[model samples]
Target: MSNLVRSELLKIRTTSTWWWLAIGAFLSIAMAFPLNAWLFNTAVEGNAEDVGLTGDAASAPAQAANLYTSGQYLGLMFVMLIGILMVTNEFFHQTATTTFLATPRRTAVIVSKLIAASLLGFVFWLVTTVIDLGAGAIFLTLNDHGTLLGEWEVQRALLLNLMAYAIWTVLGVGIGTLITNQLGAVITASVLYLIGTQVVSVLFFMLSSWLDSLAVLKWQVLWPAVASQVMITPGENEMLPAWWVGVLVLIGYALVSGIIGVLLTRRRDIS
Candidate 1:
């Protein structure tokens, strides 16, 4: 298993895909951090209502937590793409047959890919977290809010953000398994993740309004992307489920994806 994972990692490291995704993630963080900081500042500086933030939602701890976890929206998509590529590449390069024949244990190979993808996700999370913390600290200090690291809310957000990254990557692997065509998988996942989430959110909002129930809004977390956001949301929110609920929703999706991936791969005719 260790050897198989190492082999997979080596494949990733040898390719340009990983670095290109990493660069995209970095640029995403670079653009998002300042914007998030500015929005947080705007909300706190007597215009909280303008941004729909009030009371606890507009507090230093909550805003700082959101700021510190910046770039997660797009970063997770990139991480998921990495996962998709990990599996699709095998089929794309016509290496799936070779890989399965060499190992003979399809389950082991799948597990190894899962591990490798998770590690890549962790690396992405680490890089973005470091960048967020550095910039967050500076921005907070200049704005007189401090780092807010001492607060449990901020810490929890960061921890959950890591979980989000790992889970999304695994989900990506599942997506790849389901869609073997590399280009199709990438385009589908990217569109569904980036655009689908927005469309879904809007639909949910319309539904909630039509039904005139705030409870309907909570259902939005069922979407993986929204779950990721909810999981890292600090403090209490009436319109969303608890942070732990978001974690469970995401875990449930990842588990379903993994099980399906393994079952499909075990029976798949690579030849």
Candidate 2:
């Protein structure tokens, strides 16, 4: 059991993809520093509404969470790539056959990959989260708008956002394992989670505006549902489901995908 986890971790360490993804995640999160500075500076100058935040919405804590979480969502794309690579690499390089021969139990291999992906994803999240919040705090303090480092809501949001990144990695593993075609899996997962959801949300919004009967579909979009769970902020509309509901919806995807991936790995003849 321990050996499986170790092997998976070793697999990750031996690869260059992990480091490159890590660097990308860091840079992606770091972009928030300057953007946050601008937002806070403008809000402090009484232009909060210009930034789409008003009243207490322009508070330091609120802005800080927004900045930090904005990076988190952006960094998710890289983390998703990381997760996709973790499993697909084995197949791409024709290493899965040897890996299964050594372990014999395909379930163990899948479980190991899942566990390792989670840990790796968590590390990515931790690094980006630290950099994001740290940079935001420094910039906010320097700008005299104060910092939200000690705010409970911001802290909670940070934690949830980190969990969301990790969850995406797990989801990536499931998708990668199920699809197997490296490029296809990556593109499919990206489109489904990233672009597909946004398209659905936008279309739903448009339809709802034109015909109120379609308003119920607004809460059913995949990405926004998950976003509501992971984000500490409210959705752009009031129709999205509750946070817990989103969590369950995401978990449903993870569980179903993981199961199907495992079943396919067990049944498919890996030549």
- TM-score of each candidate structure, all chains considered together: 0.97, 0.88
List runs of model 1 lying over 4 Å from the truth: none
> Taking the tens digit of each residue's C-alpha lDDT, what string does model 2 give over 121-175?
7888787777776777777777776776788767867877766777777788888
Each prediction's total of clashing residue pairs, residues at least 3 apart in sequence or on different chains, is 0, 0
Local accuracy of candidate 1 as per-residue lDDT tens digits, 1-271: 9999999999999999989999899989988998889878888787988887777678878889989988888899999999999999999999998898789999999999999999989999999999999999999998887788999989988998999999999999999999999999999999998899999989999998999998899999999888888888765556878888889999999999988999999999877
Q: Which runs of model 2 end up more than 4 angstroms from their true locations? A: 43-46, 54-59, 213-221, 224-230, 234-237
Candidate 2 — which pairs collide?
A: none
Candidate 2 residue-wise lDDT at 60? 65
Give the best candidate by lDDT. 1
User: What TM-score does prediction 1 earn?
Assistant: 0.97
Error of 1 at 152 (Å): 0.8
